[model samples]
Target: MDDTEILSSSEQKMEDASTESPADAIAVTHSSDDSGDSDSDSEDEAESNHQIETLESELSANPYNYDAYVQYIKLLRKTANLEKLRQARKAMSAIFPLSPSLWLEWAKDEASLASSDNVPEIVKLYERGLSDYQVCSLVYWKQLLE
Candidate 1:
């Protein structure tokens, strides 16, 4: 009939259905799930952070290591650290002009996250990307049109 009544009814049903009290059952379930999830998530974050640090050090040591830059970019993208991703892209672009495919991928990422407020920024990115090419690129132009 009301919140308390409904909760009591539900707890009654749960009590009838199992040997454990409803609160105890919920507590056990949540404790197990929360601990397991947090442990795995922290481990994953640590590992990803470690990888990112290693990649950053490698890039620092050899600024011209294109493969390392690519790996760092990919890792940052995978982790969804957008600010760091932007920095990585900028660093890589400064060291070596991004390939057409790389530019397209970067544009796609920006486009996916673009809001009305950020659309102009994305447009600027596209323009910069296009200007990087020695010749006009139809693929990039089509993407911009879309």
Candidate 2:
């Protein structure tokens, strides 16, 4: 057979053996491969964090504005911005300490997480509350369950 005919026949044989119609032959993808990569999600996350930082900056301008302080706290928590959570807690508690119910809720959330996994964020939250707030909490008691 001619070279062109031989190659064509081989291609058809491979297509048949693989149960893929010649018209259906398309490339398969592997997730770990960097080829054809996209970064839309990372860009979105950066944009969101930037927006939150802007809001925090605006809210922080008025120290006595307790509602703004709370907005900062909620935004910081949602964005996983630990530095700002600490800062927000400090600024929020400057004239107003965390109420006992709020302290209890935060500690209870920390206490309920699974312990075996290395969850540093949760640990940081617990430590920040203990050291900075001077608010009695259940983080220690929950760890004793381990």
Candidate 3:
């Protein structure tokens, strides 16, 4: 067999071996669930907290680390830590005013809050986003209209 064919066949075998049958997977999951251990949940929370702290340290050392900010924001969102998410979003928006994606995400998050008090803030956010992206793309205008 050619080198490429040999590599592909081996890769396919690896993939097949890595995949478990649905029944087998469910059995394993059921066994774990039957253990009734809260330790894993606490461990996961601790790990998430550690990750947030590490990302905060990275951001502190390099405030312009946009990728770090994104990671931090994602972690906050995943944990439903709204307060931290808002702070992170505000900081990132201040640093990256021209980032259309950031603005859109922030605005959408605000919209999700569905608070009457947030209406004005959401409008302001959309306006700010439009200021940077309105002329660049029709999608921004469409979003504004919607």
Candidate 4:
């Protein structure tokens, strides 16, 4: 057989063999790569905490630092620090009427963690968002229904 034909035939045979008994061709892998990264995770947490502290100080110095509030909120969200996230959002809302999009994001985040106890709080947030804009937000309405 020509080289091309030979290679094609071998490949076909391998495919057929695998298809005949897929279980035999399956691999069971155990990776230890993630197990060694605990130290790195701690280091990252420390770095994020330092950044949060710095941002907090900036906000304290000038509560009108809009960018700092945004960054702080983003970092808190990334860390899934719910209490801190709530406080950050509250602080920002106090300083500026939160945009519809920000309200939507905050509502969604809270909804994801919502329980029966906090349903009223979520509805209040949606109502507040709807009131913030001169025009009604269809997205907010849709999410509120959901």
**What is candidate 3's lDDT per residue for 1-146, written digit by digit as tens?**
67798668546634642343323333444554554445864675689899999999999999999899989987776555668878998888788764776677667666766578768777888898888765666776676556
Top candidate, metric TM-score: 4
Q: Model 2, poorest ten-residue lDDT window? A: 21-30
The collision pairs in model 3 are none
- Between candidates 1 and 3, which one is better according to TM-score? 1
Candidate 4 weakest lDDT stretch, 10 residues: 21-30
Candidate 4, residue 57: Cα displacement in angstroms equals 0.4
The lDDT values for all models are 0.75, 0.53, 0.70, 0.74
Off by over 4 Å in 1: 1-38
| Superposition error at 25 for model 2 (Å) | 42
Error of 2 at 28 (Å): 28
Q: Candidate 2 on 39-104: residue-level lDDT in tens? A: 643564577678777766776575777676666665555444555665666666666766544444
Using all chains and alpha carbons, the TM-scores for the candidates as numbered come to 0.68, 0.42, 0.66, 0.73
List the candidate 3 regions with Cα displacement exceeding 4 Å: 1-37, 134-136
Q: Over the stretch 1-146, how does candidate 1's per-residue lDDT look in tens digits?
A: 77798668557734542443223434544554555356754675689899999998998899999999988887676556778888989989987989887888788777777777988888888887888886788888999888
Number of backbone collisions per candidate, in order? 0, 0, 0, 0
Model 2 alpha-carbon drift over 4 Å, by segment: 1-40, 108-146
By descending lDDT, how would the candidates be arranged? 1, 4, 3, 2
Better of 2 and 3 by lDDT: 3
